[model samples]
Target: LVTVNLTANTDLNSAEEFEQLVIRESGGAVVRLKDVADVVLGAEDYDSEVRFSGQKAVFMGIWVLPNANALDVLSGVRTELEEINRDLPAGLEGGIGYDSTVYIRDSIDEVLKTLAETLLIVVAVIFLFMGSLRAVVVPIAAIPLSIIGAFFLMQMAGFTVNLLTLLAIVLCVGIVVDDAIVMVENIERHLSEGMKPFDAAIKGARELVGPVISMTITLAVVYAPIGFQGGLTGALFREFAFTLAGAVLVSGIVALTVSPVMCAKMLKPGMEDHGFARLVNRGFSRLRDIYGRALDAVLAARPAAYFVWAVIALLCIPMFRMSPSELAPSEDQGIIFGIVDAPANATVEETARYAEAANDIFFSEPETDFSFQLTQPSSGFSGMRLKPWSERERTPNEILPGLAAKLDRIAGISVRAVTPPSLPGGGNFPVEFIIASTAEPEQILEIARTLQQKAAASGMFAFPPIIDTKIDQPEAEFLIDRDMVASLGLNLRQVGEDISAMVGGNYVNRFNIGGRSYKVIPQIQRAGRLNPDQLESIYVTGPDGRLMPLGAVATMKQSAQPRSLNRFQQLNAVKLSGVAIRPL
Candidate 1:
């Protein structure tokens, strides 16, 4: 085949040109292309359709830039979506279908609050034990320097301030303060021995250098194995482990470099025993005496201490057996999606109606910020975002049961309300069951439906389990009579070509008019090909060069067939998935 490029011109700019273009001269009369074929404007045919919640809809995904801040990106998207909703035509709506950052922001805020409270507690404990404001100041100074130094290293390593990294920083708050505490306590001991402030600071730091280095290295080593974990576990925790190790290492450096200097400048030659300091000292001294007496008693009753230890060890078996285990905890992000599936042969318009009805249930709730629906032929999906936690009394979890009940009341469609997965890339449901077999599709579907019913009846899941199997779609089958074709002087190949060209249309040729090439497809008019009955009236060129009716040579029948087939491990399979009602 040879290919050629041609520039489009004004004469053939529109569909009307197909009707005007000359096909050939027949019997010395001009025969336009329309004389033998139909030319009309219609939408391009689509082969693939998207369905969510068993409803027809289009899929859209939003991506954040590599260097962009997630919180900032989320804020911008929310603002823009709000603006878009305002400008949308009446009855149109928009909403976020799935947002990963919602949980990220919430987790970070809670972690930060915990870090602040922890810092306050640590400072108070230091002051109470040391009984000197100067001694307390030394450890407090180390906190900010170490944390800020971790941030600097994070920036250098191109790490973003995400949930895992922030968690690492929170843990470092406790671990990093240990080095400073050891240094200040040693220096205070020297001060109590009547040494000068400068001499005590130098000697105290020198004496603890070995121990400080050992402690820092030991903590870092404990986290090092986490960084080396294999597969997905490694990918998720490596950043967290390394960030914590870096913070501890930096804290040790700060203690060695700046801690002694601060102590020398801030401390007085002798400890002051007045006001809060004297009271705190007395309280700590009494605690030490009580601890000392308790320790001596334990040492003297060695057999009783061993018996108590054995009892504690025996109790651990029940505790271990009773505790729950899970891969990841569930998260509520104030959003949920309802998947809607109609019968396989349903139209997009029908799916849209079902989706809109489901959306009405969500919109009726006071907690809903907004609701949106999407529909494709045979299936549809709806999503809604709830008001923030501060504004709403109930969470998505609380709202879900009511919403599911309401959705169940809707007729002609199956609906499932699913929460977003806890971990990124995890499946939508907490558990998925795959039934693989070499059996026929009908048998596989029967098994799947039975499993779904049993699962729903068990009351162990949030809703009825979804059976992932295709429905039978309506199809037309043409049974050609070879005897009738031969009697009518009709060739089967010619009849097929003519029918295909007239009904389904054919790209017979291409033309150019405006620097772009356009295909020329000619088919029977919509009025002539609107229904299966019209197939009888279609004309086919027989071998005798005479026009023959298609109905005379063939018959059409309607039946149902699977719309799609899915396989797993080279075997036909049906899948079932649902969220567990109780934590597993």
Candidate 2:
């Protein structure tokens, strides 16, 4: 229901406001967007995302409501967006476009009609060979019942009536009834040889049932692996397997139960066999005679046949040299892309601005599709994710080059931009590393430098040097003497409380407006707040109710600290990861 570009730039506050406004205006029918989906705002996601020629870019896609008609809802959404685009903010302009998944079912339905026509042609061929319309009717009657049975089972199993599954059923339209036709034909053959209709119906099926059942079971067993062994592709293909299994199983049962009963009543006396089957039977009978004679001729010339076999084996050796071995299938999922990046030590506001700038191009042209940014992924250094979409526009492979040219013009970037890669599953990467450590910051800088050198020397990863490293941020590190604080009659907790009030501030409660809540923040006035050099001058109350200068027992100076710290297995550590292409 909700998706994001890994590198999009929309203000988190603004995206939150827009989401809340929509939910509020809907009169709570769509009560909790976050409950049903993750309405995250951040940079576009990159796992399975595309980048414009290694520049940050993103594309988004939306799934239609389960119960709603896709075309109707999408059309209404398009209309609403067109109206909204008339009043965009300055230097901000974009247009919405369409994607085929919105209307693909309708197209599939059109294809199904052609498939149905082909099926009818196949049925007509069956009648022509049997020389009786009754033969065609016998098998065709099982088609609808078989299809209905599949639908009922799919519904019971909580499966959506999707294209991949339906294509299997469409494919069965011609083949499903073939077994019944064969059983009925064999019964007609028995009748021509002077057997009673009831006896022929029963005996003919009794003779053929073993082979018919074995063939049907073979098909079901072949397709059975899809249901058990498949991974993500299995989820898509399993339904096809099950649907075909169901149709084949149902048609087999119908062939044994219904087709025989129908044959007894419908098949006429003295019906003639004609068409390709008749020609096949006669020609094949003569070919058997020819083959027997040829076998004797070949046995007498066995030396020449062995010479031909040796020559063919010699030719096949070179074929192995031309064959390719692959580890995984190459992917091509339309043309859209996604991207997520962050500037060095960027505040959330600055990150949002960069993301919005990147998102601007995605939303600019009318032909451009959809764009998304996870503007506020989470608190504490989590940047945004952006994704954009296009319809008639070029694919990610085509547009990335041009998009890279455009993004290079932007300033203040910390990482070399990269495009999203194609993936089988449409999703964003979850792991993002922000390298920070507490070893005097300068020591941490050295650690990062060593890591980059080692990784580059490994000759496995081809990306640019690790770039999250940066100059340490200035902080006030105070060393308070324990005995001096006791002499002042002030405990450490009291000093901590006073410092928290002066710096970290306090959260005052909330105000409710029309059932909505907003946080109220309280803090010292900006001009009165303590800076690193001014920390020494700040005064704190002692236990005897006397004012004492903070400089007396605690020394303060400008020192560096990491923006964040990470722990691995309860020990401080730094994490680094990136995509690996063809490795040495």
Candidate 3:
């Protein structure tokens, strides 16, 4: 608030101004804020805290705008972070914790490289067979245009450029150009029979239109079931199936229309058989003669061929048994989460110290870009992001073994570096089991430890199996005497309240200071509450208004107990989890 007068004016808009304002006045004296209470600048109390790399820090998340390009958003965010880093103080830094664009870019780039290599192979094979450069160009030109045309259909179907769709396009590089190749081959056949280029193209396309449509429909029907599938399979492959079907349909159209027209315009009456083409033609001719001889021999000795095929089929049984199978292949996502656990009785600060030691080791690695640490009372987690795939030689999977080794050496903490599962509704590990028991927690713990040890000794797991149970937290039990309390004129409630106030702080009331209200809580000083022996000094009031020592009414003993209890289907359960050395 601001105060104004005709001759004088004062601005009192800041908290300091309000704090310094006088609240009471007397003769030759005044009661300002300093007279009644202490006023010092400090940070406001927070309900939650965040720690990174074992140091207290703030965490922030950036979300891409709806419908915005992911690469563009990532670029903008990276640029802003660079600028922010420049302005930060020395020894302070900022870095990306997670970036989806890395995986998306890598997947697309690999698929594109595969697509290009496939195109080259297809072109080379076509040239080797036809021995004509002009005929090869027809299929090469049809491939791109047909694939691009599918994007229009994809747009209409509300699909975006993603891994599945790009994969479909890559696959279409071969399938989409099939019809065009057939058309060109037939046109070449007609040309060899002395027909004109235009007439040959028209006759070739007319004869193959029915067959091309039939082939396209057959391929489309194969993928139609994929699009209609339910559950996870359908959700994953719907885009892939539709994209391939659309590309095949477009190619069929191009074969009937653009292919014939282009062939008529570009293809010549005959190909020159000389130089490289002549050499390739000679090689192909020799190969064809050998194939013809082998086919005739196979037909004459069908029993021998059948016997060889039968032996090969029998061998396939053992081959299949030896092959590894998995629901999803593991992908290196350029990040790994290290879950660190301290003893159950450890404080948050102690856990943070352990996390810091682990983080130091992580940062020392040349491949690590940055790391974020989260510490709780007895557990902590470190999320370490590696350098980009293009920048680093080793992937997260390749580096996990070394990192886990270093983290395992950190004292007072157990750390496990885990790559998140590719699929949802599962733990990070490949194998997980639950041990349910109706017995006591001690028996359950013993059984779980025995099973974990057996599993570890089997040498079938990448890491020792971990049991999800904790029973190391420190506790104290107080045995109270009701008769002694009643005789001392002190009730149980009074004793309870006194103990609570001493340990947990007693909330008195609320009061205002500088226009802000605050709760007032007072408790016993640190030295008075440090040991169980000190409990004897804590006094409770009796009905006679006399103080009675708490030790006279209760006996205290130390013990250890489980931090938490877990149940499965109304029965206590211990969860065991580990990664398998081989897929199961």
The lDDT ranking, best first, is 1, 3, 2
CA lDDT, every model vs. true structure: 0.80, 0.61, 0.80
Candidate 3 has its poorest 10 consecutive residues by lDDT at 40-49
lDDT of 2 at 215: 77
TM-score per candidate, chains pooled: 0.83, 0.58, 0.79
lDDT of 3: 0.80
lDDT of 3 by residue, 82-136 (tens): 9999999998888766777887788788888888898899888877776777777
Model 3 CA deviation exceeding 4 Å by range:
1-56, 60-94, 113-129, 272-279, 422-425, 436-444, 477-502, 505-553, 569-571
Two-way lDDT contest, 2 vs 3, winner: 3
Q: How far is candidate 2 from the true structure (C-alpha RMSD, Å)?
A: 13.5
**For candidate 2, lDDT tens digit of each residue in 1-584?**
88976876433343345345333225446554343334333332212332232233333556776577666766787787777768877754444333444335454675678778867787777766555677677888778867777787788766666666678788777767878888987998898898888888999999998988997898778776787655666765788888778778777878888889998888765654455545645665698999999999999999999999899999898886766633333232333333445533345556556555665655543444444444321111111122333335444445544665565555633222333443334333212344554455456657767777776677544343443434465567778888999886779988876666555645445544456564444344445653566766777777686667777878875665665655545545555544333322
Worst-scoring 10-residue span by lDDT in model 2? 377-386
Instruction: For residues 147-184, write the lDDT of model 1, one tens digit per residue.
Output: 89889888888777888888898888878878988898
Which of candidates 2 and 3 is the stronger one according to TM-score?
A: 3
Error of 3 at 518 (Å): 8.3
Taking all chains together, the TM-score of candidate 1 against the true structure is: 0.83
